[model samples]
Target: MTTQPPPRASRPALAPRRAVGSRRALASRPALLALVVLLAAGLFGTAPASASGPASAASAPARAAASDVVAQAPGPLVWADEFNGPAGTLPDPARWNQEVNGSGGGNNELQYYTGSTDNAALDGSGNLVITARQGNPRGYQCWYGTCQYTSARMTTAQSFTQAYGRFEARIKLPRGRGMWPAFWMLGNNLGQVGWPASGEIDIMENVGHEPGRVHGSLHGPGYSGGSAVTGSYTLPNGQAFADGFHTFAVDWTPTSITWLVDGVAYQTRTPADTRGNPWVFDHPFFLILNLAVGGNWPGPPDGGTAFPQSMVVDYVRVHAPGSSGGATGAVTGLNGVCLDVAAAQNANGTPIQVYGCNGTAAQVWTVAADGTLRALGKCMDVANNSTADGAPIHLWDCNGYLSQQWRFTAGRDLVNVAADKCLDIPSANTAPGTRLQIWTCTGAAHQKWSPPAG
Candidate 1:
């Protein structure tokens, strides 16, 4: 696991992550073909077709049946990289920023991360292959001196960031001693806030010695490094993750994050899991994928360790909040009162309140594909972007800020994405002009809403 330190003025780096700790025991290895079949049949199940890119290198029937399952598990597809391209070509530059450094990732990792295709490239078979090989031919200097191995680390830091969603990757891991591969994310404010204070989410991590198990963890102030909250998932029947491709994912919401492998959830961490520490994951975070060698957690490669180990990634996909876009109708709250623009005003900062469902222009709310709840050509916004419990709700010109984004949860709660709170009718007042506000999500009746009909 990468434990990179704060970014130095001269260079940006990851905080030192994961310490050597007790791991869950390994199960017996299952047959590779059986695992693949099980994943195709069970993991995908028989869900309706979801919007996704081209199918993988599977048969027509199998691909048609299972290709959309992963994307369907979340909401609508927002971002994706199928890794489809000619052999030896690099990943799409617009979607990834490959870090070129040998800072050791603050974990004493031995690999020199390079942008060269030699370390990371697309295979002709629709996969992004990150190869870790012995010897740094360019004589790259690491923190310890000459680098002994070469690998790749890439992130979407510059291109994309999301607050709550489902992030997933299908990967076939590398084996042998000292191999460290991870699918994780760091808060977008890392450069400004620094280290644990910026938050880290380890969706999936595996050390070479633990072939049957993978870990998921959270790190933030007061509970980071070895003290980070974490859990492990082991493949049933002695399966080695390297034997075949497996899907690793995390479903993240404002209040909790759940980890899953092959579509089977193994652990769910919530605010209470922090033990009074802050839940710093309320903001957006960017994705990271990397393979390292000889880190402190995995130790150095022995003579028996193999050279040229590679992590093969089939695709990476993300889905936004569950609410369907393009839905337009009245948003009814407590006592079935429609959420209205006060006095039917279209001016900015006009208060939003509960009123009778008269089907007037004032009550027409549109759930835009970009996550905004719009009416009168303005977005429903948190007044002044406040995070306080009684932050007022009003109309504002849509600027695509987080404060204007609203997510309709399955529980019928209208959540303000930025503040991680619920839209509420103040004091449960159902009066026609009762101004609305945002308060801590307590699943109260006043916090629930009947979102716009699709």
Candidate 2:
């Protein structure tokens, strides 16, 4: 969870136990409010007037169509929070741990986060409402002095963590200057590795000053704070995201992380995008949701600002690997030859090769949701985790290693995640026992493959 900046400055290092300060600037309050009012009235079609209202029925079809276009993860639902409890109830204690603090979020923020239902609670209508209200009634002392605002920040750190898959949430953001709402994630090893080093994935963050835009960012060792790798999506026609609900999601794979809003992909980051810095995202991470008031990036609320602003959430969901859309059959390459394990071997380091398709057990391959290609109870792996051309492909025990990950590109190339290379048939050889290797992706016939029909 972090703040938005005018020049993409450093964001708050948001975690349950710690806060790190950073500065950022945004548009003047009056101009932003005017823009938001105009956009909300003109661009929001059939959307609810307020976050507390029920979802519009007329928008269901469009949402479903948009979902159909999204490249959904081939997995089953592993975790979710629908917030269907009685009104005024807290979030499920089993899944969320609400943080209580007056630490200012390290961004010079004004809100003192609390575990009270007044700050965060479930509506009878299936939504998690995180409200930012004026006046801290608890007499909480903040970093600077007495707290002037109160809000809620919740996390799934103690309940769940996953390495790779789909993480998403549907949220209706709050508006007014100084309101900052976010749905994000942090590495589960945060206690050990600490901020930035533990990695931060800001799936969606919207500052009140920019009601029409939301940002997605990645923070790591060298590219953290104001220097984080980030991108923003602006609603067309000056539409304010606060006018309705939008789904924010990230498809995290072994090699890439793709950001999507309302089912449309806008940006994708790969290991290569790190600028030679270590990619620290290949590990388990937990989720966080918060609505902050008056931070460094958004400044403080002005005269036009309203009280009891709520960031309403419809749901938060996670999908596990290999729960859907996988095939188990012949994985054919050039000349329709099947990818096979030598001698039907199940031992580690057994060569993976090309052989005439004979419907044999050795030819059977399963495209796994975690990006690994499996056969004979083993994954197709790079020999010695090598990136050099002609590094042999072999069978190894199924492990969540970058060397074992593969992505079937639109161009039909089977690329390795760790090596950033292609699975190749050396010399374009058609021999039945030709061993496969990792080579620079060349878009050649020898590097093409057709995975089994799903």
The candidate scoring highest on TM-score is 1
lDDT by residue (26-70, candidate 1, tens digit) is: 221123224444664577663222111123334111221110111
lDDT of model 1 at position 194: 78
lDDT of 2 by residue, 1-454 (tens): 3533222112222453222223232332223334444554457654333221223543211111111112233356789998999999999999999888787765777889888999999989999999999997679998889999999999888889998888889899999988889899988777776676888898988888889988888888787767777777676668898898888888788877877666445567888878899999999999999998887677899998989899999999887653223677887899989999999988888899999989889988887766678888888878765557988999987655556767654346677755557899999997989999999877699998876765
**Clash count for each candidate, listed in order shown:** 13, 3
**Candidate 2 CA-lDDT value:** 0.75
TM-score to native of every candidate shown:
0.61, 0.60
What stretches of model 2 exceed 4 Å from their correct place? 1-72, 322-453
Candidate 1: stretches off by over 4 Å: 1-73, 323-454
What RMSD, rounded to one decimal, does every model reach? 17.2, 17.4
